[model samples]
Target: MRKNEDNKNIAVIYWSNSENTEIMAEKISNGIDETGQKADLYNVSQFPIERIEDYDKVALGCPSMDGEALEKNTFEPFFEEIESKLKGKKVALFGSYGWGNGEWMRDWEDRIGHTGARLFDEGLMIKEFPDDAGRHACVEFGKAFASF
Candidate 1:
């Protein structure tokens, strides 16, 4: 595990329509900061993917929509573009959902795994909005990813 003195660069990019996912992103970034790592948090729509290569670890969050899946507009496109660049990088995933088993997360984890990035945690999922526990889990996920 990486120590706080390693000073890794971490990024958290997320897409949220109801602000739930954004909340998780913030918690995750806080966790990264706790590890003495620099963390950049950005909304998926406004994030600059071209700069992703500058980070040592990346954490992504996206809510499930229309069943079990990621929001199509911004999250999918952004991930597609960065997928290849993620090989051998440490990555973490988190999101919120209204229903269904966590199929979206499962599928997403598999997709990200295909890129050869190491997954830090099982990934977090909230039913609708995250409560205190979910937020804390997000933070822990970020810390673990940064330590990787």
Candidate 2:
């Protein structure tokens, strides 16, 4: 089953300030690897918007920031830049939250809808840093996404 999986077409991009969201991103990548698809992991700043077409599927992660919004300085701008490129692509979203409900993720899901991108699943949100169970969940989410 692991004989011919390619690694070039899937990417996991995330932005984290407190490192909680980054941890989730790593686990999700682990899951994707488990499915025999080696996904590229990148911080938002490290990923160029022009490369959106290079990946058929993408996992985006950003923690809740400043009143339940995306981290403005980097991730928000990156997302805005790539929103148009997501049309017909498979996209998944995940992140960590320190407070409030998951309003940010819902809004994000809606935005992806506007672009005509197919969502791999509902947004995955974890409060604060993820414990062992949460980590396992992230990995499973990644596995499913890769399989999708």
Candidate 3:
């Protein structure tokens, strides 16, 4: 509802092997735009983790892999790269999962908490491709995250 962040920049970064998470990231970006803000979307490999401090807010996305865990190779290392810098940062999280009760998100949330970042809200998780409701929720999450 608030469009005061016209000049603010947000980052939506994610890792998606099947590209489902990419769609969610794009939806989050659309939500940020609804708030009259800017969102830069990036694949985890394409984003420079050290540049995380450049954005006013950040949205991180990844799919649950290898038993409801963050991807061991790319996303995990990228997240670890930015973990320390997250202290005092504003952040949101989203992901697509094949199954397993969203335990990966819970673990991720706990990690984010330990970093002292201000969590925008509960992390959004979608099973495989997000349905209409999931996409709507992602948009809402983006709008709220940008406004905050």
Candidate 4:
């Protein structure tokens, strides 16, 4: 994977109520940082989404909520607001799920497909809370995303 991203702009924006998704976000950001690249990380509340066009690549994280769906309250609205704005950007998704065979992630991926963003690989889903290996997986995902 490419370890250098001297001119790329990347963002990792996430919303986490339970803190599980937050941990994953941290690890993913760590992987990006380890590669000598910096990712602008933000909680969805703190994200300056008006500057969406400033980023060439973005990583989004949220947990499954309300029967295998994206978190409806904050994350969903933000995603909807930005969906049409994401055309031509490289977008990656990740989330934590507690049940329902990860159908939520698949549906979310399909939605991204319609947005004109180049969805990177598959969306990463962690069952419930991530353990040590899951954290490693998140880090690896970050590395791969950086290279992508």
Best-performing candidate as measured by lDDT: 2
Candidate 3 lDDT, 1-148, residue by residue in tens: 1223555568999999997899899999999888777788899999976688777688999999998999999999899989999888798989999879999999999999999999878899999988899899889988888877
lDDT of 2 by residue, 20-117 (tens): 99999999999998887788899888897888888888999999999999989888988999999999889999999988999999999999999999
Q: Regarding lDDT, does 2 or 4 come out ahead?
A: 2
Question: What C-alpha lDDT does candidate 2 achieve relative to the native structure?
Answer: 0.90
Where does candidate 3 clash, by residue pair? none
Query: Candidate 1's residue-wise lDDT over 1-148, tens digit each?
Result: 2324565667788999898988998999888888787688889888877888876788899998877888887788889999999988888899988889999999999998899998877878888877888888877877777777
Q: Candidate 3, residue 51: CA error in Å?
A: 1.2
Candidate 2 displacement at residue 55 in angstroms: 0.5
Please provide TM-scores, in order, for all candidate models, with all chains considered together: 0.91, 0.94, 0.93, 0.95
Q: Which residue pairs show backbone clashes in model 4?
A: none
Q: Total backbone clashes of model 4? A: 0
Error (Å) of candidate 4 at residue 126 is: 0.7
CA shift of 137, model 4, Å: 0.3
Candidate 2: stretches off by over 4 Å: 1-8
Which residue pairs show collisions in model 1? none
* Predicted structure 4, TM vs. truth: 0.95
Candidate 3 residue runs with Cα over 4 Å from true position: 1-7
Clash pairs for candidate 2: none
